[model samples]
Target: MGRLTDKVAVITGSGSGIGRQIALTYAREGAKIVVADFNEEGMDQTVSQLKEMGAEAI
Candidate 1:
C-alpha cells in the first residue's frame, strides 16, 4: 500500500508546473488531493486530471 493512502492533502499553485505534478503524484498514492490555483482554467484541468486519478480537490 502507498504511504499516503487515505491521507488528505492540499496543494497551492497546482494549476500548472511542479505544484500540479506534486498533486497528481500524491493522488496516485491514494491521497485525497486538493489543487488550488489563481488560474481558473488551469485549475479546472488539474482538477479533472485528479478526478481521473480517483482523487478529489476542494
Candidate 2:
C-alpha cells in the first residue's frame, strides 16, 4: 500500500506543471484529490487524469 493510503489531499494550482505533477503523485500514493485551479479546463483535465488512475477527485 502507498504511504498516503486512505488520505485526501487538496492541491491548488493542480491544473498544470508542478502542481499537476504533485496531484498525480499524491493520487498514485493512494490519496483522494481535490484539484483546484483558476483554469477550469486545466482543472478538469487534472481531475480526468486522476479519475483514470482510480483516484477520487473534484
TM-score winner: 2
Q: Which regions of candidate 2 fall more than 4 Å away from where they truly are?
A: none
Clash pairs for candidate 2: none
TM of each candidate vs. truth: 0.89, 0.96
Q: Look at candidate 1 and give me any clashing residue pairs.
A: none
lDDT of 2 by residue, 1-58 (tens): 9999999999999999999999999999999999999999999999999999899999
Where model 1 places Cα greater than 4 Å from the true spot, the runs are none
**Candidate 1 least-lDDT 10 residues:** 49-58
RMSD of each: 1.0, 0.5
CA lDDT for candidate 1: 0.87
Worst 10 residues of 2 by lDDT: 49-58
Give lDDT: candidate 1, residue 32: 89
